[model samples]
Target: MPVVPPPVFALAAGIAQHLLAPDRPAGGARKLASAGIAVAALGLDASAVAAFRRHHTTVNPLDPARASSMVTGGAYRLTRNPMYVGMAGLLTAHAVRRGGWLTPLPAAAFVVLVDRLQIPAEEAAMEANFGEAYARYRARVSRWLPVRA
Candidate 1:
Protein backbone atom coordinates (compact mmCIF):
# COMPACT_ATOMS: atom_id res chain seq x y z
CA MET A 1 0.00 0.00 0.00
CA PRO A 2 1.14 3.48 -0.78
CA VAL A 3 1.77 5.66 2.25
CA VAL A 4 0.57 9.21 2.36
CA PRO A 5 2.98 11.41 4.29
CA PRO A 6 1.52 12.31 7.69
CA PRO A 7 2.05 16.07 7.47
CA VAL A 8 0.36 16.28 4.07
CA PHE A 9 -2.59 14.32 5.33
CA ALA A 10 -2.80 16.45 8.47
CA LEU A 11 -2.77 19.65 6.44
CA ALA A 12 -5.32 18.39 3.94
CA ALA A 13 -7.65 16.99 6.57
CA GLY A 14 -7.39 20.10 8.77
CA ILE A 15 -8.31 22.36 5.87
CA ALA A 16 -11.08 20.03 4.77
CA GLN A 17 -12.52 19.90 8.25
CA HIS A 18 -12.41 23.67 8.53
CA LEU A 19 -14.15 24.01 5.17
CA LEU A 20 -16.84 21.56 6.24
CA ALA A 21 -17.72 23.49 9.39
CA PRO A 22 -19.53 26.78 9.90
CA ASP A 23 -17.31 29.78 10.48
CA ARG A 24 -16.42 30.30 14.13
CA PRO A 25 -13.77 32.91 14.77
CA ALA A 26 -11.53 32.14 17.67
CA GLY A 27 -11.88 34.30 20.78
CA GLY A 28 -8.85 35.79 22.53
CA ALA A 29 -8.31 32.89 24.92
CA ARG A 30 -9.05 30.34 22.23
CA LYS A 31 -6.61 31.97 19.84
CA LEU A 32 -3.95 32.03 22.53
CA ALA A 33 -4.56 28.38 23.37
CA SER A 34 -4.51 27.37 19.73
CA ALA A 35 -1.26 29.25 19.10
CA GLY A 36 0.33 27.64 22.12
CA ILE A 37 -0.73 24.20 20.98
CA ALA A 38 0.56 24.84 17.49
CA VAL A 39 3.87 26.15 18.80
CA ALA A 40 4.35 23.15 21.04
CA ALA A 41 3.48 20.84 18.19
CA LEU A 42 6.03 22.55 16.01
CA GLY A 43 8.59 22.07 18.76
CA LEU A 44 7.87 18.36 18.85
CA ASP A 45 8.16 18.15 15.10
CA ALA A 46 11.44 20.07 15.18
CA SER A 47 12.78 17.84 17.95
CA ALA A 48 12.16 14.78 15.84
CA VAL A 49 13.85 16.39 12.88
CA ALA A 50 16.76 17.36 15.07
CA ALA A 51 17.09 13.81 16.32
CA PHE A 52 17.12 12.49 12.77
CA ARG A 53 19.68 15.07 11.82
CA ARG A 54 21.88 14.24 14.78
CA HIS A 55 21.74 10.54 13.86
CA HIS A 56 22.35 11.31 10.19
CA THR A 57 19.34 9.19 9.34
CA THR A 58 16.77 9.63 6.61
CA VAL A 59 14.03 12.09 7.55
CA ASN A 60 11.69 11.29 4.70
CA PRO A 61 8.78 9.26 6.07
CA LEU A 62 8.09 7.63 2.71
CA ASP A 63 11.51 5.94 2.70
CA PRO A 64 11.96 4.17 6.00
CA ALA A 65 14.51 1.72 4.63
CA ARG A 66 16.91 4.57 4.12
CA ALA A 67 17.06 5.24 7.84
CA SER A 68 20.59 4.89 9.17
CA SER A 69 19.51 4.82 12.79
CA MET A 70 16.40 4.14 14.88
CA VAL A 71 16.13 7.24 16.99
CA THR A 72 14.97 6.53 20.57
CA GLY A 73 16.26 9.44 22.57
CA GLY A 74 15.14 13.01 23.33
CA ALA A 75 11.64 13.41 21.83
CA TYR A 76 11.65 9.73 20.87
CA ARG A 77 11.87 8.95 24.56
CA LEU A 78 8.49 10.62 24.96
CA THR A 79 6.59 9.00 22.07
CA ARG A 80 7.44 6.28 19.58
CA ASN A 81 6.34 8.44 16.66
CA PRO A 82 7.03 12.03 17.61
CA MET A 83 6.65 13.44 14.12
CA TYR A 84 3.19 11.96 13.71
CA VAL A 85 2.31 13.01 17.24
CA GLY A 86 3.42 16.52 16.39
CA MET A 87 1.29 16.56 13.25
CA ALA A 88 -1.69 15.34 15.27
CA GLY A 89 -1.11 18.15 17.75
CA LEU A 90 -1.08 20.73 15.00
CA LEU A 91 -4.29 19.25 13.59
CA THR A 92 -5.85 19.42 17.01
CA ALA A 93 -4.89 23.09 17.31
CA HIS A 94 -6.41 23.75 13.92
CA ALA A 95 -9.59 22.05 15.04
CA VAL A 96 -9.66 24.09 18.22
CA ARG A 97 -9.02 27.36 16.42
CA ARG A 98 -11.82 26.66 13.93
CA GLY A 99 -14.40 25.79 16.62
CA GLY A 100 -17.08 23.50 15.21
CA TRP A 101 -18.39 19.98 15.75
CA LEU A 102 -16.82 18.92 12.46
CA THR A 103 -13.44 20.42 13.36
CA PRO A 104 -12.29 17.35 15.24
CA LEU A 105 -13.19 15.07 12.38
CA PRO A 106 -9.97 15.82 10.49
CA ALA A 107 -7.75 15.20 13.52
CA ALA A 108 -9.59 11.94 14.16
CA ALA A 109 -9.15 10.88 10.54
CA PHE A 110 -5.42 11.73 10.76
CA VAL A 111 -5.05 9.55 13.84
CA VAL A 112 -6.74 6.61 12.16
CA LEU A 113 -4.65 6.93 9.01
CA VAL A 114 -1.30 7.35 10.75
CA ASP A 115 -1.88 4.73 13.43
CA ARG A 116 -3.32 2.09 11.12
CA LEU A 117 -1.20 2.62 8.05
CA GLN A 118 1.92 4.76 8.57
CA ILE A 119 3.19 3.67 11.99
CA PRO A 120 2.70 -0.04 11.29
CA ALA A 121 4.74 0.05 8.11
CA GLU A 122 7.47 2.09 9.74
CA GLU A 123 7.58 -0.24 12.77
CA ALA A 124 7.86 -3.28 10.57
CA ALA A 125 10.75 -1.78 8.69
CA MET A 126 12.47 -0.83 11.93
CA GLU A 127 11.95 -4.34 13.26
CA ALA A 128 13.34 -5.86 10.10
CA ASN A 129 16.42 -3.71 10.53
CA PHE A 130 16.91 -3.34 14.29
CA GLY A 131 15.11 -6.40 15.66
CA GLU A 132 15.06 -6.69 19.49
CA ALA A 133 16.47 -3.25 20.11
CA TYR A 134 13.61 -1.72 18.20
CA ALA A 135 11.16 -3.93 20.06
CA ARG A 136 12.56 -2.72 23.37
CA TYR A 137 12.10 0.89 22.34
CA ARG A 138 8.58 0.17 21.18
CA ALA A 139 7.77 -1.42 24.54
CA ARG A 140 9.13 1.59 26.36
CA VAL A 141 7.57 4.41 24.40
CA SER A 142 3.89 5.10 23.87
CA ARG A 143 2.84 5.22 20.22
CA TRP A 144 1.06 8.58 20.19
CA LEU A 145 0.87 10.41 23.52
CA PRO A 146 3.94 11.38 25.50
CA VAL A 147 3.61 10.07 29.01
CA ARG A 148 7.09 9.23 30.29
CA ALA A 149 10.65 9.20 29.12
Candidate 2:
Protein backbone atom coordinates (compact mmCIF):
# COMPACT_ATOMS: atom_id res chain seq x y z
CA MET A 1 0.00 0.00 0.00
CA PRO A 2 2.96 2.24 -0.43
CA VAL A 3 1.68 5.41 -1.94
CA VAL A 4 3.29 6.27 -5.21
CA PRO A 5 4.68 9.75 -5.23
CA PRO A 6 2.16 12.34 -6.39
CA PRO A 7 4.68 13.64 -8.84
CA VAL A 8 5.01 10.19 -10.37
CA PHE A 9 1.28 9.88 -10.73
CA ALA A 10 1.07 13.39 -12.11
CA LEU A 11 3.86 12.79 -14.58
CA ALA A 12 2.43 9.50 -15.75
CA ALA A 13 -1.05 10.90 -16.04
CA GLY A 14 0.24 13.91 -17.93
CA ILE A 15 2.14 11.72 -20.34
CA ALA A 16 -0.88 9.54 -20.87
CA GLN A 17 -3.11 12.52 -21.50
CA HIS A 18 -0.58 13.87 -23.93
CA LEU A 19 -0.48 10.61 -25.84
CA LEU A 20 -4.22 10.40 -26.11
CA ALA A 21 -4.72 14.07 -26.93
CA PRO A 22 -4.54 13.59 -30.64
CA ASP A 23 -7.30 11.02 -30.73
CA ARG A 24 -9.52 13.04 -28.47
CA PRO A 25 -12.52 13.22 -30.68
CA ALA A 26 -14.64 16.32 -31.06
CA GLY A 27 -17.73 14.46 -29.94
CA GLY A 28 -18.65 11.20 -28.24
CA ALA A 29 -15.26 9.58 -27.72
CA ARG A 30 -13.79 12.68 -26.20
CA LYS A 31 -16.78 13.22 -23.98
CA LEU A 32 -16.83 9.62 -22.87
CA ALA A 33 -13.16 9.52 -22.03
CA SER A 34 -13.38 12.80 -20.20
CA ALA A 35 -16.32 11.64 -18.14
CA GLY A 36 -14.73 8.31 -17.47
CA ILE A 37 -11.52 9.84 -16.23
CA ALA A 38 -13.38 12.36 -14.12
CA VAL A 39 -15.59 9.76 -12.52
CA ALA A 40 -12.80 7.31 -11.90
CA ALA A 41 -10.51 9.93 -10.46
CA LEU A 42 -13.30 11.20 -8.26
CA GLY A 43 -14.05 7.76 -6.91
CA LEU A 44 -10.43 6.99 -6.25
CA ASP A 45 -9.86 10.30 -4.59
CA ALA A 46 -12.92 9.90 -2.44
CA SER A 47 -11.91 6.46 -1.28
CA ALA A 48 -8.40 7.67 -0.57
CA VAL A 49 -9.75 10.54 1.44
CA ALA A 50 -12.04 8.28 3.36
CA ALA A 51 -9.19 5.95 4.05
CA PHE A 52 -7.15 8.85 5.29
CA ARG A 53 -9.93 10.22 7.43
CA ARG A 54 -10.38 6.88 9.10
CA HIS A 55 -6.66 6.84 9.85
CA HIS A 56 -6.29 3.57 7.94
CA THR A 57 -4.37 4.79 4.94
CA THR A 58 -0.72 4.08 4.20
CA VAL A 59 1.61 3.75 1.26
CA ASN A 60 3.93 1.32 2.88
CA PRO A 61 3.27 -2.40 3.13
CA LEU A 62 0.05 -3.31 4.85
CA ASP A 63 0.72 -3.18 8.55
CA PRO A 64 -2.01 -4.31 10.90
CA ALA A 65 -0.91 -1.44 13.08
CA ARG A 66 -2.03 0.94 10.33
CA ALA A 67 -4.88 -1.10 8.89
CA SER A 68 -8.28 0.51 8.43
CA SER A 69 -11.71 -0.62 7.37
CA MET A 70 -12.12 -2.10 3.90
CA VAL A 71 -13.57 0.48 1.57
CA THR A 72 -16.13 -0.72 -0.99
CA GLY A 73 -17.87 2.44 -1.94
CA GLY A 74 -17.99 4.65 -5.01
CA ALA A 75 -15.55 3.43 -7.65
CA TYR A 76 -14.78 0.40 -5.53
CA ARG A 77 -17.97 -0.93 -7.02
CA LEU A 78 -16.22 -1.20 -10.37
CA THR A 79 -12.67 -1.95 -9.26
CA ARG A 80 -11.12 -2.79 -5.92
CA ASN A 81 -8.09 -0.58 -6.31
CA PRO A 82 -9.83 2.46 -7.68
CA MET A 83 -6.97 4.85 -7.05
CA TYR A 84 -4.46 2.72 -8.87
CA VAL A 85 -6.93 1.93 -11.60
CA GLY A 86 -7.90 5.56 -11.91
CA MET A 87 -4.30 6.63 -12.23
CA ALA A 88 -3.78 3.96 -14.87
CA GLY A 89 -6.84 5.17 -16.74
CA LEU A 90 -5.58 8.72 -16.67
CA LEU A 91 -2.31 7.49 -18.11
CA THR A 92 -4.13 5.44 -20.71
CA ALA A 93 -6.33 8.32 -21.77
CA HIS A 94 -3.22 10.40 -22.22
CA ALA A 95 -1.70 7.74 -24.38
CA VAL A 96 -4.86 7.53 -26.42
CA ARG A 97 -5.03 11.28 -26.69
CA ARG A 98 -1.46 11.49 -27.85
CA GLY A 99 -1.92 8.66 -30.29
CA GLY A 100 1.55 7.49 -29.38
CA TRP A 101 1.93 3.75 -29.82
CA LEU A 102 4.78 3.76 -27.35
CA THR A 103 2.75 5.48 -24.66
CA PRO A 104 1.71 2.19 -23.10
CA LEU A 105 5.01 1.49 -21.39
CA PRO A 106 4.59 3.62 -18.31
CA ALA A 107 1.03 2.55 -17.80
CA ALA A 108 1.98 -1.06 -18.22
CA ALA A 109 4.85 -0.63 -15.82
CA PHE A 110 2.49 0.91 -13.33
CA VAL A 111 0.25 -2.09 -13.67
CA VAL A 112 3.08 -4.52 -13.14
CA LEU A 113 4.32 -2.70 -10.09
CA VAL A 114 0.92 -2.48 -8.50
CA ASP A 115 -0.12 -5.98 -9.29
CA ARG A 116 3.11 -7.75 -8.49
CA LEU A 117 4.17 -5.72 -5.52
CA GLN A 118 1.63 -3.42 -3.93
CA ILE A 119 -1.56 -5.38 -4.50
CA PRO A 120 -0.31 -8.78 -3.45
CA ALA A 121 0.98 -7.37 -0.21
CA GLU A 122 -2.23 -5.50 0.41
CA GLU A 123 -4.29 -8.57 -0.39
CA ALA A 124 -2.32 -10.69 1.99
CA ALA A 125 -2.85 -8.20 4.75
CA MET A 126 -6.53 -7.91 3.95
CA GLU A 127 -6.81 -11.65 3.97
CA ALA A 128 -5.16 -11.80 7.32
CA ASN A 129 -7.46 -9.15 8.64
CA PHE A 130 -10.79 -9.90 7.00
CA GLY A 131 -10.28 -13.59 6.35
CA GLU A 132 -12.89 -15.14 4.03
CA ALA A 133 -14.66 -11.91 3.24
CA TYR A 134 -11.58 -10.54 1.61
CA ALA A 135 -11.11 -13.77 -0.29
CA ARG A 136 -14.63 -13.61 -1.61
CA TYR A 137 -14.11 -10.05 -2.69
CA ARG A 138 -10.90 -10.96 -4.37
CA ALA A 139 -12.62 -13.76 -6.18
CA ARG A 140 -15.22 -11.32 -7.39
CA VAL A 141 -12.97 -8.49 -8.50
CA SER A 142 -9.97 -8.75 -10.76
CA ARG A 143 -6.77 -7.42 -9.26
CA TRP A 144 -5.64 -4.91 -11.90
CA LEU A 145 -8.21 -5.39 -14.66
CA PRO A 146 -11.94 -5.76 -14.44
CA VAL A 147 -12.94 -9.33 -14.96
CA ARG A 148 -15.16 -9.97 -17.96
CA ALA A 149 -15.91 -13.53 -17.09
Candidate 3:
Protein backbone atom coordinates (compact mmCIF):
# COMPACT_ATOMS: atom_id res chain seq x y z
CA MET A 1 0.00 0.00 0.00
CA PRO A 2 1.11 3.52 -0.76
CA VAL A 3 2.03 5.68 2.21
CA VAL A 4 -0.44 8.37 3.11
CA PRO A 5 0.85 11.91 3.35
CA PRO A 6 1.18 13.77 6.63
CA PRO A 7 -0.97 16.62 5.39
CA VAL A 8 -3.75 14.11 4.80
CA PHE A 9 -3.51 13.05 8.43
CA ALA A 10 -3.55 16.68 9.48
CA LEU A 11 -6.65 17.30 7.38
CA ALA A 12 -8.41 14.29 8.80
CA ALA A 13 -7.57 15.42 12.30
CA GLY A 14 -8.99 18.84 11.60
CA ILE A 15 -12.16 17.26 10.27
CA ALA A 16 -12.39 15.05 13.30
CA GLN A 17 -11.89 18.02 15.57
CA HIS A 18 -14.75 19.83 13.88
CA LEU A 19 -17.01 16.83 14.16
CA LEU A 20 -16.23 16.45 17.82
CA ALA A 21 -16.41 20.11 18.76
CA PRO A 22 -18.74 21.72 16.25
CA ASP A 23 -17.11 25.11 15.99
CA ARG A 24 -19.08 28.00 17.35
CA PRO A 25 -18.67 31.43 15.82
CA ALA A 26 -15.99 33.21 17.76
CA GLY A 27 -16.20 36.73 19.12
CA GLY A 28 -13.87 39.46 17.89
CA ALA A 29 -10.90 38.85 20.18
CA ARG A 30 -11.07 35.09 19.96
CA LYS A 31 -11.38 35.26 16.18
CA LEU A 32 -8.34 37.49 15.96
CA ALA A 33 -6.26 35.26 18.19
CA SER A 34 -7.16 32.15 16.25
CA ALA A 35 -6.27 33.83 12.98
CA GLY A 36 -3.01 35.06 14.39
CA ILE A 37 -2.03 31.64 15.66
CA ALA A 38 -2.92 30.05 12.35
CA VAL A 39 -0.94 32.62 10.35
CA ALA A 40 2.10 32.24 12.57
CA ALA A 41 1.94 28.49 12.29
CA LEU A 42 1.67 28.77 8.51
CA GLY A 43 4.66 31.07 8.51
CA LEU A 44 6.63 28.51 10.49
CA ASP A 45 5.81 25.86 7.91
CA ALA A 46 6.66 28.25 5.06
CA SER A 47 10.03 29.10 6.57
CA ALA A 48 10.90 25.44 6.84
CA VAL A 49 9.96 24.94 3.20
CA ALA A 50 12.00 27.96 2.19
CA ALA A 51 15.00 26.66 4.13
CA PHE A 52 14.78 23.36 2.27
CA ARG A 53 14.60 25.20 -1.05
CA ARG A 54 17.55 27.37 -0.13
CA HIS A 55 19.64 24.30 0.61
CA HIS A 56 18.45 22.64 -2.61
CA THR A 57 17.11 19.78 -0.54
CA THR A 58 13.99 17.73 -0.94
CA VAL A 59 11.07 18.54 1.38
CA ASN A 60 9.44 15.25 0.57
CA PRO A 61 8.79 13.62 3.91
CA LEU A 62 8.24 10.23 2.33
CA ASP A 63 11.75 10.24 0.90
CA PRO A 64 13.98 11.62 3.63
CA ALA A 65 17.05 9.90 2.20
CA ARG A 66 16.88 12.24 -0.79
CA ALA A 67 17.59 15.29 1.36
CA SER A 68 20.80 16.74 -0.05
CA SER A 69 21.66 18.90 2.92
CA MET A 70 20.85 19.29 6.59
CA VAL A 71 18.46 22.11 7.44
CA THR A 72 19.28 23.36 10.93
CA GLY A 73 18.36 26.99 10.49
CA GLY A 74 15.13 28.96 10.16
CA ALA A 75 12.11 27.17 11.66
CA TYR A 76 14.22 24.03 11.83
CA ARG A 77 16.21 25.61 14.66
CA LEU A 78 13.01 25.70 16.67
CA THR A 79 11.77 22.18 15.97
CA ARG A 80 13.21 19.39 13.87
CA ASN A 81 9.75 18.87 12.43
CA PRO A 82 8.37 22.34 11.84
CA MET A 83 5.82 21.08 9.39
CA TYR A 84 4.40 18.75 12.03
CA VAL A 85 4.58 21.48 14.63
CA GLY A 86 2.72 23.82 12.31
CA MET A 87 0.01 21.24 11.76
CA ALA A 88 -0.37 20.73 15.50
CA GLY A 89 -0.43 24.46 16.04
CA LEU A 90 -3.14 24.86 13.45
CA LEU A 91 -5.16 22.16 15.14
CA THR A 92 -4.64 23.86 18.49
CA ALA A 93 -5.88 27.15 17.05
CA HIS A 94 -8.94 25.38 15.77
CA ALA A 95 -9.52 23.78 19.14
CA VAL A 96 -9.25 27.14 20.84
CA ARG A 97 -11.80 28.66 18.52
CA ARG A 98 -14.15 25.69 18.83
CA GLY A 99 -13.91 25.48 22.66
CA GLY A 100 -15.17 21.96 23.19
CA TRP A 101 -13.41 19.77 25.70
CA LEU A 102 -13.09 16.95 23.21
CA THR A 103 -11.91 19.19 20.41
CA PRO A 104 -8.27 18.79 21.30
CA LEU A 105 -8.38 15.01 21.25
CA PRO A 106 -7.88 14.61 17.54
CA ALA A 107 -4.99 17.02 17.52
CA ALA A 108 -3.37 15.17 20.39
CA ALA A 109 -3.91 11.90 18.58
CA PHE A 110 -2.31 13.29 15.43
CA VAL A 111 0.78 14.29 17.33
CA VAL A 112 1.09 10.95 19.05
CA LEU A 113 0.72 9.05 15.78
CA VAL A 114 3.35 11.15 14.02
CA ASP A 115 5.75 10.96 16.92
CA ARG A 116 5.44 7.22 17.25
CA LEU A 117 5.18 6.12 13.63
CA GLN A 118 6.72 8.83 11.48
CA ILE A 119 9.67 10.45 13.24
CA PRO A 120 11.88 7.40 13.96
CA ALA A 121 12.31 6.50 10.30
CA GLU A 122 12.94 10.10 9.32
CA GLU A 123 15.54 10.42 12.08
CA ALA A 124 17.23 7.25 10.95
CA ALA A 125 17.41 8.53 7.40
CA MET A 126 18.79 11.85 8.58
CA GLU A 127 21.41 10.12 10.70
CA ALA A 128 22.33 7.84 7.82
CA ASN A 129 22.79 10.78 5.48
CA PHE A 130 24.26 13.46 7.73
CA GLY A 131 25.83 11.32 10.48
CA GLU A 132 27.33 13.23 13.40
CA ALA A 133 26.04 16.57 12.22
CA TYR A 134 22.52 15.23 12.34
CA ALA A 135 23.20 13.71 15.75
CA ARG A 136 24.38 17.05 17.09
CA TYR A 137 21.38 18.77 15.62
CA ARG A 138 19.05 16.22 17.16
CA ALA A 139 20.74 16.59 20.50
CA ARG A 140 20.63 20.39 20.49
CA VAL A 141 17.21 20.86 19.00
CA SER A 142 14.07 18.99 19.94
CA ARG A 143 12.08 16.47 17.94
CA TRP A 144 8.96 18.61 18.28
CA LEU A 145 8.74 21.54 20.63
CA PRO A 146 11.67 23.64 21.78
CA VAL A 147 11.56 23.63 25.54
CA ARG A 148 14.17 25.71 27.32
CA ALA A 149 14.77 26.27 30.99
Candidate 4:
Protein backbone atom coordinates (compact mmCIF):
# COMPACT_ATOMS: atom_id res chain seq x y z
CA MET A 1 0.00 0.00 0.00
CA PRO A 2 1.12 3.59 -0.69
CA VAL A 3 2.08 5.76 2.25
CA VAL A 4 0.81 9.09 0.91
CA PRO A 5 -2.62 9.89 -0.48
CA PRO A 6 -3.12 9.77 -4.26
CA PRO A 7 -3.72 13.54 -4.52
CA VAL A 8 -0.51 14.27 -2.61
CA PHE A 9 1.37 11.91 -4.88
CA ALA A 10 -0.14 13.61 -7.95
CA LEU A 11 0.96 17.02 -6.72
CA ALA A 12 4.44 15.73 -6.00
CA ALA A 13 4.65 14.12 -9.42
CA GLY A 14 3.57 17.39 -11.08
CA ILE A 15 6.18 19.37 -9.16
CA ALA A 16 8.86 16.86 -10.06
CA GLN A 17 7.86 16.98 -13.71
CA HIS A 18 8.06 20.76 -13.66
CA LEU A 19 11.48 20.62 -12.05
CA LEU A 20 12.78 18.16 -14.63
CA ALA A 21 11.31 20.00 -17.63
CA PRO A 22 13.76 21.94 -19.77
CA ASP A 23 13.49 25.73 -19.93
CA ARG A 24 15.71 28.76 -20.49
CA PRO A 25 16.98 29.96 -17.17
CA ALA A 26 15.00 32.97 -15.97
CA GLY A 27 17.23 32.89 -12.90
CA GLY A 28 21.04 33.01 -13.07
CA ALA A 29 23.15 29.94 -13.81
CA ARG A 30 24.48 29.82 -10.23
CA LYS A 31 20.97 29.53 -8.72
CA LEU A 32 19.94 26.89 -11.23
CA ALA A 33 23.08 24.86 -10.57
CA SER A 34 22.59 25.08 -6.81
CA ALA A 35 19.00 23.93 -7.11
CA GLY A 36 20.05 21.05 -9.34
CA ILE A 37 22.63 19.97 -6.78
CA ALA A 38 20.03 20.21 -4.03
CA VAL A 39 17.65 18.08 -6.04
CA ALA A 40 20.38 15.49 -6.64
CA ALA A 41 21.22 15.40 -2.94
CA LEU A 42 17.56 14.96 -2.07
CA GLY A 43 17.30 12.10 -4.53
CA LEU A 44 20.33 10.43 -3.00
CA ASP A 45 18.88 10.77 0.48
CA ALA A 46 15.56 9.35 -0.63
CA SER A 47 17.34 6.40 -2.19
CA ALA A 48 19.18 5.74 1.03
CA VAL A 49 15.92 5.69 2.97
CA ALA A 50 14.38 3.35 0.44
CA ALA A 51 17.32 1.00 0.69
CA PHE A 52 17.05 1.02 4.47
CA ARG A 53 13.33 0.36 4.30
CA ARG A 54 13.94 -2.62 2.07
CA HIS A 55 16.56 -4.02 4.41
CA HIS A 56 14.50 -3.50 7.55
CA THR A 57 10.85 -4.21 8.15
CA THR A 58 10.29 -2.12 11.31
CA VAL A 59 9.93 1.47 10.11
CA ASN A 60 6.25 1.87 9.49
CA PRO A 61 4.74 5.25 10.43
CA LEU A 62 1.22 3.94 10.96
CA ASP A 63 1.33 2.85 14.60
CA PRO A 64 -1.68 0.57 14.71
CA ALA A 65 -0.35 -1.29 11.73
CA ARG A 66 3.38 -0.97 12.59
CA ALA A 67 5.92 -3.70 12.94
CA SER A 68 6.72 -4.96 16.40
CA SER A 69 10.34 -3.87 16.43
CA MET A 70 11.61 -0.28 16.42
CA VAL A 71 14.12 0.56 13.75
CA THR A 72 17.34 2.24 14.88
CA GLY A 73 19.60 1.36 11.98
CA GLY A 74 20.60 3.13 8.79
CA ALA A 75 18.80 6.45 8.14
CA TYR A 76 16.83 6.07 11.36
CA ARG A 77 20.06 6.65 13.26
CA LEU A 78 20.32 10.13 11.70
CA THR A 79 16.68 11.16 12.11
CA ARG A 80 13.28 9.71 12.98
CA ASN A 81 11.48 11.21 10.02
CA PRO A 82 13.99 10.55 7.26
CA MET A 83 11.40 9.63 4.64
CA TYR A 84 9.29 12.70 5.29
CA VAL A 85 12.39 14.87 5.42
CA GLY A 86 13.49 13.42 2.10
CA MET A 87 10.11 14.24 0.59
CA ALA A 88 10.28 17.80 1.93
CA GLY A 89 13.80 18.17 0.61
CA LEU A 90 12.68 17.02 -2.82
CA LEU A 91 9.84 19.52 -2.81
CA THR A 92 12.15 22.36 -1.74
CA ALA A 93 14.64 21.42 -4.41
CA HIS A 94 11.88 21.32 -7.03
CA ALA A 95 10.76 24.80 -5.98
CA VAL A 96 14.28 26.19 -6.06
CA ARG A 97 15.05 24.61 -9.41
CA ARG A 98 11.90 26.11 -10.91
CA GLY A 99 13.24 29.58 -9.95
CA GLY A 100 10.75 32.44 -9.90
CA TRP A 101 9.26 34.97 -7.46
CA LEU A 102 6.60 32.40 -6.74
CA THR A 103 8.96 29.42 -6.91
CA PRO A 104 8.46 28.45 -3.26
CA LEU A 105 4.66 28.37 -3.27
CA PRO A 106 4.32 24.69 -4.06
CA ALA A 107 6.94 23.74 -1.50
CA ALA A 108 5.20 25.90 1.09
CA ALA A 109 1.92 24.23 0.24
CA PHE A 110 3.55 20.81 0.71
CA VAL A 111 4.91 21.78 4.10
CA VAL A 112 1.54 23.12 5.24
CA LEU A 113 -0.29 20.02 4.05
CA VAL A 114 2.14 17.60 5.68
CA ASP A 115 2.44 19.55 8.91
CA ARG A 116 -1.25 20.35 9.28
CA LEU A 117 -2.69 17.09 8.03
CA GLN A 118 -0.41 14.05 7.66
CA ILE A 119 2.14 14.49 10.47
CA PRO A 120 -0.32 15.37 13.20
CA ALA A 121 -2.37 12.29 12.51
CA GLU A 122 0.72 10.09 12.37
CA GLU A 123 2.18 11.57 15.56
CA ALA A 124 -0.98 11.06 17.53
CA ALA A 125 -1.18 7.47 16.45
CA MET A 126 2.49 6.91 17.24
CA GLU A 127 2.15 8.51 20.65
CA ALA A 128 -0.80 6.32 21.50
CA ASN A 129 0.93 3.14 20.40
CA PHE A 130 4.55 3.69 21.35
CA GLY A 131 4.07 6.06 24.27
CA GLU A 132 7.41 7.09 25.86
CA ALA A 133 9.46 5.45 23.15
CA TYR A 134 8.00 7.69 20.48
CA ALA A 135 8.35 10.71 22.74
CA ARG A 136 12.02 10.00 23.31
CA TYR A 137 12.57 9.51 19.62
CA ARG A 138 10.82 12.81 18.88
CA ALA A 139 12.95 14.57 21.48
CA ARG A 140 16.06 13.28 19.80
CA VAL A 141 15.19 13.59 16.12
CA SER A 142 14.32 16.87 14.43
CA ARG A 143 10.93 16.92 12.71
CA TRP A 144 11.91 17.73 9.13
CA LEU A 145 15.61 18.53 9.62
CA PRO A 146 18.64 16.73 11.02
CA VAL A 147 19.18 17.17 14.71
CA ARG A 148 22.01 19.65 15.28
CA ALA A 149 22.70 18.78 18.87
| Top TM-score prediction, candidate number | 1
Quote each prediction's TM-score.
0.94, 0.65, 0.93, 0.66
Worst 10 residues of 4 by lDDT: 60-69
Compared to the true structure, candidate 3 yields what TM-score?
A: 0.93
The alpha-carbon lDDT assigned to residue 114 of candidate 4 equals 68
Q: Is candidate 1 or candidate 2 better by TM-score?
A: 1
Which scores greater on lDDT, model 1 or model 4? 1
TM-score of 1: 0.94
Candidate 1 lDDT over 1-149, as tens digits, reads 34678878988998897797677568998799999999999999999999999999998888787778889899888888888888989988888888878888989999998888888888888988899999999898899885754
Per-candidate clashes, comma-separated: 0, 18, 0, 0
Among residues 3 or more apart in sequence or in different chains, the pairs in candidate 4 whose N, CA or C atoms overlap within 3 Å are none
Cα RMSD for predicted model 3? 1.7
Best by lDDT: 3
Give the lowest summed-lDDT range of ten residues in model 2.
Answer: 57-66
Estimate, for each residue in 1-149, the C-alpha lDDT of model 3 and write its tens digit. 11767788889999998898854777787678888989988998888888889999998878888989998988888899999999998998998787779989999998988888778878999999999999999999989999995
Q: Rate the local accuracy (lDDT) of all candidates.
A: 0.86, 0.64, 0.87, 0.62
Off by over 4 Å in 1: 147-149
- Which is the winner by lDDT between candidate 2 and candidate 4? 2
